[model samples]
Target: MEIGKLPNDMLQNIILNKIKHFRNDILVRPGIGEDCCAIDFGEYSCVMSSDPITGASNEIGRLAVHVSCNDVATCGVEPLGLLVTILAPVYASEKEFDEIMGQICDTAASIGVDILGGHTEVTDAVNRFVITTTSVGKVLKDKLVVSSGANPGDDIIITKSAGIEGTAIIAHDREDFLLERLDAHDIERAKGFTGSLSVVKEGVIAGKLGASAMHDVTEGGILGAVWEVATASGLGAEIYRESIPVEDITQKICNIFDIDPLKLISSGCMLIACKNGNEMLKALEASGIKASRIGKMTEDKETFIISRGKKELVSQPGTDELYKAT
Candidate 1:
């Protein structure tokens, strides 16, 4: 299972079945496979998503809050509130725990998202601190955006660049090594990228500007997110490699690690399925976000990716390489 997702049967039996206890009051709108879960909350639908800060330990609180909020934003909705749960290992310190919570609260306040309620516990089952946040949002019934909303003939637009999140993490995690090779200015630029996590402003704008679907690139890089969107939508796409924007530092890091830039985790970037490609691109540009029409949605039933000077496919094997690489 190097690069593949858990087997469907195993997942359904061990994971999905546990969530099968649906009740009459709880309706699953737009179904699974979407970036965010949609629930009918009377007047407007609520989009919810959750994730834990397991890959990187530094900036655990800030990352946890933004990552959870990013998912709701991907559904073209603003995060209204967040529910966080922190599992602290027995050896965790009170000062460190308080600092993490303080960062989470500050991040939430900056984003105008409220912290609802969550559970905190000290346990021996975990060796490190794990913070998970569940975000809630409201999306109008008419303006719902799902990963499966992409249609043939729509244009594929990606904001920011590939591997932004991964680069930031590696730079922060390996600060000493990076400082040895790169200058202080470069390090500062990479560190500043953490602020790019939430795509709320751009997402809401794109939704208003006519994006058919929106997906945040995360665990799987741009390639993984694209594949998921296409597979879930029962569609195909062709994305040009040269059109993707990757910072020089990010490119250098990928070269050093021998990892495909497109296959790396990209939390700061958002994939747009634009019905009017030009207009969406312009809108993103006007908002100071670097966006480009990289490709087009297709009906071929096969995802195709072409790189800048490479003749081969840079697309993923319909699997997340993040888990394997880490």
Candidate 2:
């Protein structure tokens, strides 16, 4: 098995197949590309998502909150609260535990979300500290968005640049190694990429503007996200390779490791599908969020990435490139 997310096929065959949906109030259930689940709450739908921070050791608390909240935002809902669980190794110190809790508190405060309640304990079950966050949000039933809602002919828009999270993680966790081959200034800039790790604002804007679908770019990066959106919608996609934005620092770091920037993890980027892409782009610009229309959903059932007059079929995302670097 891979170190990151389960491959799409294994997830479908082993996990998704065994799960049964019994309640009528559940609007969304577990599925490929569907990060958040929405349950009917009368006039509103309560959205929730859970994610664990395991890839990086530096900012586990902060990343835990943002990653789960980003999943909730993918449904175009602003997260209101979080239930955080911490599992620390036996060798962990109280100071380290306090630091993690402080980060969780500070991050949740910054995002206007409350830390409701959760369990924390030090055990020998794991090697390092692992923080998992389950974020909760609410949205009107009529306005709820799902990753499978994308329609053919809708334009695909991406927010922010590629590999935003991976760049920051590698720069922070592998600073000593990077410092040997890269300039200090460049490494510092890459670490600063964490400042742009939230997609809640753009998610709300796109949702309010009637985006057909939205998927938060997480473990799989931009290309993997495009594949998920298309697969979940039962449609195909055509992405222009040159249109995907990549920061110079990110490129340099990836070049050092010989990894594909397109396949790297990108937490800050949001993948949106809408009928009026130009209007969506304008709205995002007005809000001061950088975005680009990289491609479109297609009637065909085969997804492809076109670059320099060549088309390459997109494969199901395997292990994330982040694992390789980390």
Leading candidate by lDDT:
2
Q: What is each predicted model's overall lDDT from 0 to 1?
A: 0.80, 0.94
- Model 1, backbone clash pairs (residues 3+ apart or across chains), number: 0
- State the lDDT at 312 in candidate 2: 100
Collision pairs in model 2: none
Candidate 1 positional error at 200, Å: 0.8
Question: Candidate 1 on 1-326: residue-level lDDT in tens?
Answer: 54445443455477766765555534344333466778777768878988878777777788899888888887788889999999999999999899999989998998999999999999999999989999999977678777788899999999899988887777777777777778878877877778787788888888777678888888668877787677677888888888888899888766666777888888879999978988888888988988878888889677878876554543433444344334
Q: TM-score of predicted model 2? A: 0.99
Ten contiguous residues with the weakest lDDT in model 2: 317-326
Runs of candidate 1 exceeding 4 Å displacement: 1-32, 308-326
Best prediction by TM-score: 2
